[model samples]
Structure formats: C-alpha cells, structure tokens
Target chain A: MAQKKNIKNRATSKPSSLVWIMLILLIMGEFFLYAWSRVQCTRMGYEITREENKYKNQMNMRNNLQIELSRLKSPKRISLIAKTRLGLIRPAPKQTVIIR
Target chain B: MKFDNHKQISRRAAIIGIMFAGLFIMIGIRVIFLQTVQGPWLSKKAANQYEKSVIIRGKRGIIFDAAHREMAVSIQATSLAAYPGRIKNKNEAARKLSNILKIRFKNLRRKLETGRSFVWLKRQATPRQVQAVKALNLKGIGFIPEFNRFYPNKTLGAQVLGFSGIDGRGLEGLEFYYNAYLKGSERKIRVLTDALGRQFDTGQTNANGLGGNNIILTIDGNIQYITETALEEAAKKYNAESGIAIVMAPATGAILAMAHYPFFNPNAFNSFSRDRWRNRSITDSFEPGSTMKIFSAAAALDSGICDPNTIFYCENGEYRIGRNIIHDTKPHGWLSVQQIIKVSSNIGTVKVAEKVGGRSLYNLFKKFGFGNKTGVDCPGESTGSLSFYNKWSNIDKGTISFGQGVSVSALQLTSAAAAIANDGILMKPYLVQAITDQNGRLIQNFSPQKIHQVISARTARDLKRIMETVMTEGGTGVLAALEGYTVCGKTGTAQKVSTHGGYSKDKYIASFLGFAPAKKPEIVILVILDEPKKEHYGGIVAGPAFKKIAHQTLQYLNFTPLRQKKHQRVLAENEVSG
Candidate 1:
C-alpha cells in the first residue's frame, strides 16, 4: 500500500508544475500590454492639452481685433468726425433712398 | 533500475525541470521587491500616468457708461487654426481653407506647409466664415471659443472713458483707473477626457474664474450725444482749429459730458495718432479771458468791496493803464456791475478790478479753484497761471480783472462756474461715480463731494443774478437763448498770444460758459472754440453751439419753460371774457 501511494504522488506533480508555468506567462504578457497602453494614453492627454492652450491663445488674439473693428465702426464716433472734419451733414429726406 | 525507468530520468527532463524552477524563483523575488521595496515608487508613477486632469479658463468683464448702458463688453467668438500634423492632404487643405476663409491660397499653403506641427488658419472669423469652413469638415482645421471687448457707444466720451488692453486690462481713461475692480480672479478646473478628444459626461465648475469689475460713470449718454453733435457741427462750420464742450452737474462736480475734438476710438488705439489720444479738457491750458471776470467779480463781491449796483465809467469801451489801452468789442458809457457783465466790457471789468484791488481779486480767483489743480481723475492737469497778488504789478492786476494775464483750462473755468451754481461751494470734479462687482453688487459709490465753500450763498445768488442778465436781451448770450426760455451766460473772446511772435492778429479763442433757465438752473454748459478763423466773436462762434445743446437737453429733460404757466390763467380768463 505504501508503494501505491508513492506512485500516485509522482503522477500528479508534473502536470501541476506545467500548469503554474503557463499561468505565470499569461500574467506577465497582460502586465506588459497594460503598461504600454498607459504610456500611450498619457502622451495623448499631453497632446490634447497643448493643442487646447494653443487654440485659446489664438482665439484671444482674434477677439481683440474684432473689438477694435466694431469700435472703429460705431456710428456715434464716425458721425462726429464726418460732421466736424469733413463738413458732411445728415442726409436730408430727399437724399435718402427707400428701396423695396 | 526500476525507479530510473519509471521516472524517466533523462538529461532533457532534468534540464526542463531546473529552468522552470528558476523562472518561478525570479517571479517570487520580483513580487517581494514590488510589494515591499518599490511599491511606493510604482504607485506614484501609475498615478501620474493615469490620473485625469483638466484646465479652467476665465472670461473677461464688461464696461458701462454712467447710465448703466453698455459701453464695452467681452463677447464670445470662434477662432480657426489648423493641426498640420493631422492633415491628410496639404494641397487640398490649403485650397479648401482659402475658399472658405477668403485667404490667399498661396499664403495658406505656405503657412500650412511650414515645418511647425500647427498653425493659425484665421482669427476672429465671422460667424458666416466659421460656418462655411466647419461645413467643409476639413480634418486638420479646428475652432475654439474666445472673447473680445465691444464698445457699443464708441467715441461718445472717448477721452473720459479711455480704453483697454488685449488681455482685458484697462489701458487708459476710466478703464485704467478702475482696472483692479474690473478684472476678476483666474480659476483652474480638473477634467477627464478620452483619447478621441471627447470630454467626460459631466464636468465640474471652477469657483475662481477670471472676472472683471463693472464701472458706472457720471455721464448721461443722451446729453453727451447731444453736446458732441452740436459741438462737431459748430467746429466744422466755423473752421476752428480745435474745439471742446463740457457739461457738468454743479452740485456734485460730476462731469456729465466732456467731448474733445480730434478724438480717437479707444478700440482701435493702434490705428490712431497720439494727437487723437490727447484729452484736452485736463491736458491743456488757455487764456481764461473775460470768463475770469465772473471770478473777479465774485472776489470783489465776496470782499464787500463792490455791490451789484456799483457804477463805473467805462471810458467808452477803452481804458488805458500804463500805456496799455484795453478795447471792448462794443462800447458802453456808464454801467453797473450787472451791465458790465452783460456787455462783456473789458474796460468795465478793469475798472471793477481797480476798485476791487489786485490782492482781493487774486484771492477771489484762488478761492474759485484757480491757480491750483481741481484734483480731477485725469492724468495731467495744470494749476493754471494766477500770479501771486504781491507778485503782480498794478497794471497786471487790472489786466487780470478783465481776464488777461491769467490762464485756465476749459475744465477749470467750468469748475469755478460750478461753485457759483452750487451756492459758492466748490466740489471736486469726477468722471467715474462708482465701481460695481460682477454679481451687480455695488462695490463702491461716489458721493457728491464739496471740497470748499469759496463764497457765501448771498454772493453766489447775486453772482447768479448778474450772470443771468448776460443771457437775456441785454446780455452777450442773446444768441445762447433757447426759444421761449430765459437763459443765463457769459462770453469770452480771448486774444491768442503767440509764444515767439507776441500776439497774432487773427487768432482768438471764443468761449461761452453758462447755465439754463435764468431763475432756476438745470444744466451748465461750456463751449470753447479755439482759433476760430471764420468767426471771431464768442457770441457768434460759441454761443449758438451752447444754445443748441442746452435747448435739446432741457427739452429732453422736460424742463418747463422759465415763465410759469400764465397760459392756464389766460385760458380761463379768455373763457370768462368771451
């Protein structure tokens, strides 16, 4: 009976060792892939933020120009200059055109 | 022999077994290092790599006039730029962008093809331009939201309102003066985003956003518009070198409307000349001329030296002192202090000054805010030239009494007259009344400040009565009269002295200073037309301009005619008489 028990223990040991090796390989592969993807994600976030800041600065420059244009075109200011410097008067009723 | 055969004790089997054992041992060592020695380092690295981050942006503030009308504000707009690294076809992208953005194709191609990874496609593109380009669906092009300030009432009070900078900071005027209160704090926000540039489903708000403060001026927009319009008309018609018109609230010393010629639109500061930027009201000085007579008379009256009924021989519009004979525009034989002001007689004023004496006259002018700064919120102001009474010769005092040998700004003249209107009390002139926070809370309020009481109410009342006679039929301001309204005013036709060449024959500064409704005044207007070529008389050049502005303002304010409603009694009597 002692001889039979010894043979049975030897029989189970080999496959168990093989099974543990395979599990170890699988875990390492998954870990490497997860680390690689994490690096890529971080890079992408940096790129997006850099781009966003650039866009904001560009927008700021544009808005400043628009404000200047609107202010220059304001009627109250231009009309005064016209009347004072250029000797232009408001258009009389006969001078205006009403088109349909 | 039996154990070796059953176990298959081959060399290959032994080698494989040893290798597997070594691999397991390596993993065990690594696990020990990770869980014990290097765990904190690995955890920090992971946090840095994977933690979500976000940035917060702040919006700028808006500017408003005295009446809480929008003078300037930051508005949201879309700006276009390109990601050159992402473009599939550079040539195609350039063509498409040029068509939609209305930019030159060659320029677009050159900019896009630059080695830089990104470039600006356009800035501050119109909404139509934005839509057209976005509809093209170019892969490399993108837009972002930004704000720019908008001045709605441009150039209305250009000098007084001043201007701002690109980062929404105030550069000049009230904008620079109250910038700290206008610009709000900057805030930062943390956000999460996906690889495709999509934000998280929900984002959090940043508590501290860049905000600016709100400003309230003392300017009435309607009145300013009117004053500016009439002044422009007069300046052009008379071929004057430069012009200025100012209206003030006498009791509070608040400048209602102050307009300067050769003015600039602060929005386009870069496009204008520096001359246009000069705010002459506080920045320049001119001879006060006959306007100084009112202050001189105030001094004489306040000293109890001259009464209103006091008479003086005019020498028939010409008086000689030390070989200097001052001539009047019109001649008068014998005149009281009231008629002297009405005719704007230089000789009469000289005689009054002679009786009033130099020391007393100088003191009176000093008390009415001359020979010193009014402490206005503007950047530059001259105290004006009022020589010390002891410093002046007898002839100098006499010339000063008739409004020569002294200089003052349009603002100084107005402020002094304001004291007269405010019952001899001088108030500090201010343009900005208050500054409010973004939430519409009143952060500050400016009260009506009286700097000094220069004269007694009785003297002021008497001065007002005399100044009013000058606006009636007997006065210089007959032209300043509004239709069917009793007006009070004084005119100054000052001689222009050339710095190098002594005095110019044709150059004269014609100015009018006055208030409305001879009995109870509502508004005070001052018009100064400098070096008017076509017209030389103050009544002819400046009087009508003041009249138009005051009349329109009173009509707009719905101020009743000076004469009470005798029409009601007349109508009732007519019905009974009939």
Candidate 2:
C-alpha cells in the first residue's frame, strides 16, 4: 500500500513541473512581444518625423517655383522682351480684327 | 535555567518582529505622502525632459490680381541664429559666414561675440547662403523657417500693393489698411523630443487654419501695367514734377488701374523715398482745372436752368467778377453752352455757374461726390476740398466753376466722371474684389455698390454730347480724340496756388478727363500732370496720354469701332435682303 502511495505522489509531481515550465515560456513570449512593439513604435515615430520634414521642404519648393513663375510672367518683362528681343509692336486700332 | 533561556529568546524575537512591522508602516505612509502631495509636480518635471511647447506662426496671406495673378506672395526662407555661449572658434565661423552671407567680417564677428545668450546671425537668408552655412555644419548655429513677402512683379503696382516689414507687419498702402486680415495667427503646439534633442512627434495640432485669409483685388494686372508705362512715359516726356492716372469701369466703379509716376519697387521699398511710396491718386488732391466744366455743364443741364444750346455771352476772352478778372484761353463771342464747353471757355463756364447759382452748383458738386471720401478700400483717402456755398464769394463761385478754387483727388474726379459715363448713376469705387482662404475657398465677395444718381438720364446724355464736342476739331481736347470712337472729354489748365499767395504764373496743373464711346461710355480715364515744363496746356500735355490709355483700354475691352459695326450691320442687312 505504501509503495502504491509513493507512485501516485510521483505522478502528481511530474504534471506540476510540466505546468510550471509552460507558464514560464508563456511569460517570456509576452515580454518579447511587448519589447518588439515598443521598438517598432519608436522606429515609426522617427520615420514619420523624417517624412514630415520632407513634405515641408517639398511644399516650400513648390511655393518658390510658383513665385518664380509669376516673376517670369510679369507684363513688364514680357513687353520688354517682345519689343526688344522679338521686335514686336502693338497693332494699331484699325489693324486689329474682331470676330463676331 | 533552560526555561529562562526560552523566555528570553521569545521576548527578543517578538521585539524584533514589532520593529520590522513599524519600519514597513513608515515606508507605506511615505509612499502615500509622495503620491498625494507631489505627484503632479513630479510628473510635469519628468515631462519636461522629453517634451516641449513651441509657438508657430502661420504664413502670411497672398495678394492676387483680378485675373488671379499673384502680385504679392510669401515664401519660406531660413533665418540663421546663433547661441553665442555655445559657439567655439568664433573667428573661423564668422569668417566663413561673412564670405557666404556677404556680410562684413567685423560686423559678423561682433555679432558672434555678443554677450547675449542668443542673437540673430541673419534674417531671411538666401537659399544659397543657407546651403553654404549648412554644409559648414558649424556648432551653435541653427536655422528657423520664416515667411518673406515677395512682390513678383516688382514695381508694377508697388504703390497699391504696398509692402510688409521684416516682422510681417504691413506699413503702407493697402497692406496697412488690410493688415488685420493679411496677418496670420499664432498657435502653440506640444512636441516630443528624443535624447539628442530632435523632435520625434509633431503632436496633435491643425496648423492650416492659422494662416491668414488671402486677398483678391479688382485691379487688372495688364491694365495696371499699361497705365503705369504710359504715365511714366508721359511724365518723363513732359518733365513734370509728378503725375497720376486712373482707369475706372463706369458701370461697376471697379478701378482697373491707378498709376503714379516715379515708380518704386515694393521689394526694395526701404531704398526708395517715402514720397514715392504714396498712392498719390488716392492720397493727394489737386485742382481739376477746366475739367470741372463738364460737371458745371451737368449741373446747369441737370437743374434744367440751361440747355446745351443756352447762349452765354463770353466777354470775348475776359470777364470781370467783383475784384477778379477771369480770362478764357482764347476769345469767345456769344457762344452756346455747347461751343463754350468745346472751347473750354472760362468766362462762359462762370456765366453758367452764375445762372446755376452758388448753392445749386455746390449741391451739384456734393452730389457728384467731390467733397467726401469715396470710401475706397485703399488707405489714406483725401476728401478733396469744396467749401460750403455759404462761404463762397462771387470770385470763389467763378473760380470753383472752372476748377480753380476747389480741389479734387484723382480718384474722386475719376469716380465723378464715371458717374457721368454710367448715365447719371454713381457707383462706389473699390479695389479689393474678394477674400479667399488658402485652399481657394471663397470667404467673402465684394460686389458693386451703386450710390445715388447725380443727374437725370436725359441730362447726362445731353451733357455727354456737349462734352464730346470738346474732342472735336475746334475743341480744346481735340488731341485726345480716338480715330474710330467718339470721345467725350474736357481739358483743364489750372495755375498752381503759389507759395507766396496767389496762383503761380508759370506753374500749372494740366489735366484731361474723358470717356470713350460717348453714347455708351465703358471707361472713364483721368490723367494729370503737375508743373509741366514743356507745355502748360492740358490738351497739349495730358490729352495724348488720355487718348493712348483710352484707345488701348477700349481695344482691350473688345469694343468694336463704330465704323466696323456699321459695315457689319450693312453686310447683315444685305444678306437679309438677298
């Protein structure tokens, strides 16, 4: 009878040790996942900042180019070029034709 | 002895247990105190380590012309700043920056060596300079983004658009008037920084709404350019002290062009004199000279006191009133009002003024918007002087009748002429057409406003006919006549009020005020030249410019010549007959 009791006790000890090992593995996995997510969040933050800066720079460049285009299209400059470089003159009143 | 030893051991164990319990209780109380009493302060202190609050200013608004062409724009530029205490090897940094920035070495060095904790190295640095500085990667130097106002057309409409200062405050012109709407608002935002003091998060802030609302003006850029060119050429040709020209749409009262001579670039406004910075057309008033005859005739005709054919005996070149002798440029006999206006006879105008009476003429001038501000959107509008009829002596009435004693701004005269052109209805003049957001959404629209009618439609037509005679062969404004279009105009030559007291003998303000397509006038143009050296006659000096501007503007408006219209009508009639 005593030998039977000792066998039963050994069987219970084996299951408990297995359960302990499983719990420990599960905790380790959770820690690693939390750490990985944290690192990803930080990396994404840096990337977003870089992209925002690039977007701002591009917007500035567009504004500058638009201003430059306006300057180039100024009437004074166009008229000057037309008169001097292109050798053009404004048509007289009678020379111009109007389409109905 | 054994039992005694057992009791002693029990006592010692119990005392040590109590001591350990007391120590734990103290620790618990301390924790509670820290959590309750100083939690918020500690949390804030921790946040300061990696978080910052920064103030951001929105970009200033843009100014667009009638056709949506950019007149003034704001662009992002980098400003260089320095921490004097953090800078090492200041001499080398200053030397390098001086070369790149085109600043004097001594000045740059002095700025760098200042005792202040922070100082501006340069404001609104060029892109090339910023690039050179960044390439150097010098310590303690940093760049701040700022908006710089740029006038793309330079001097095209400088006096109208005005300019803003470095701090983004408007100091003159429409800029000064609309500064509140053009200036951006300030916003505060929180940002997260990393250990290296680099921003990692921009935080939750919508910055787009903070920018100023953009302005759209009624000024036509092409028309403004044409007017400025013509005015400059005319002023230079005549060697006048200054000049002003205004173009207005008769029906809408939209000022298409307001040009001032001696132009200055708003981009470099500081380099020009303050005198040149003024929009003289709106700010300064001058005698309209004989141009006032058109209004006088309108007054006489509108009051039904005199018709276009009312014969007034012009004193054959000179007429006496009280103590003053009013002389016509040339002798005139018993001339009808039409002929009198054609020749710009001063005596005839005075006689018409006499029949209309001082009170009636004053009321007419007031009705034409001579003595009050037109309430134009531009800054610094002058209410041209028109003394009360109660204060007018006989001489004042005669002089005022021919535009000698009274004064009128270029804008007021243009608007009054526009009233006549619009067939007796006076429309309030305006420059700004609308206000828009950054995304091109309409915020507000300025529509045309009509003031009271100054004359009856029939009288306005008769007055237009009499005025058209001024552009005929014997008229004083004969030079201002367009080849294919009928022009209604008046010429004015008023002697300037001499500094000593009376009118100057040689100095004169010669002007031409007129409109084209007399039957349905589309545009009214007023051109004035102050102190012309070449000639003092209004027709000789200012009539040609009036003609050029009127012709070009009418052509631009796509008005077909009367002769062409007639030919086209004839062709259509023949086609119908077939």
TM-score of each: 0.77, 0.95
Report every candidate's CA lDDT. 0.79, 0.91
In terms of lDDT, model 1 sits at 0.79
Question: What 10-residue stretch in candidate 2 chain B is worst by lDDT?
Answer: B201-210
Backbone Cα, N, C clashes tallied per candidate = 7, 0
Please report the candidate that would top DockQ against the real structure: 2
For model 2, the superposed segments whose C-alpha errors exceed 4 Å read B1-33, B203-206, B573-578
TM-score, chain A, per candidate?
0.57, 0.91
lDDT of 2 at B4: 100
B352-431, model 2: which lDDT tens digit per residue? 99999999999999999999999999899999999999999999999899998899899999999999899899999999
- DockQ-derived CAPRI band for the predicted complex in model 2: medium
After superposition, candidate 1 runs with Cα above 4 Å error: A1-100, B5-57, B80-123, B132-142, B205-209, B331-333, B569-578
B54 in model 2: Cα distance from truth in Å?
2.2
Highest lDDT against the true fold, candidate: 2
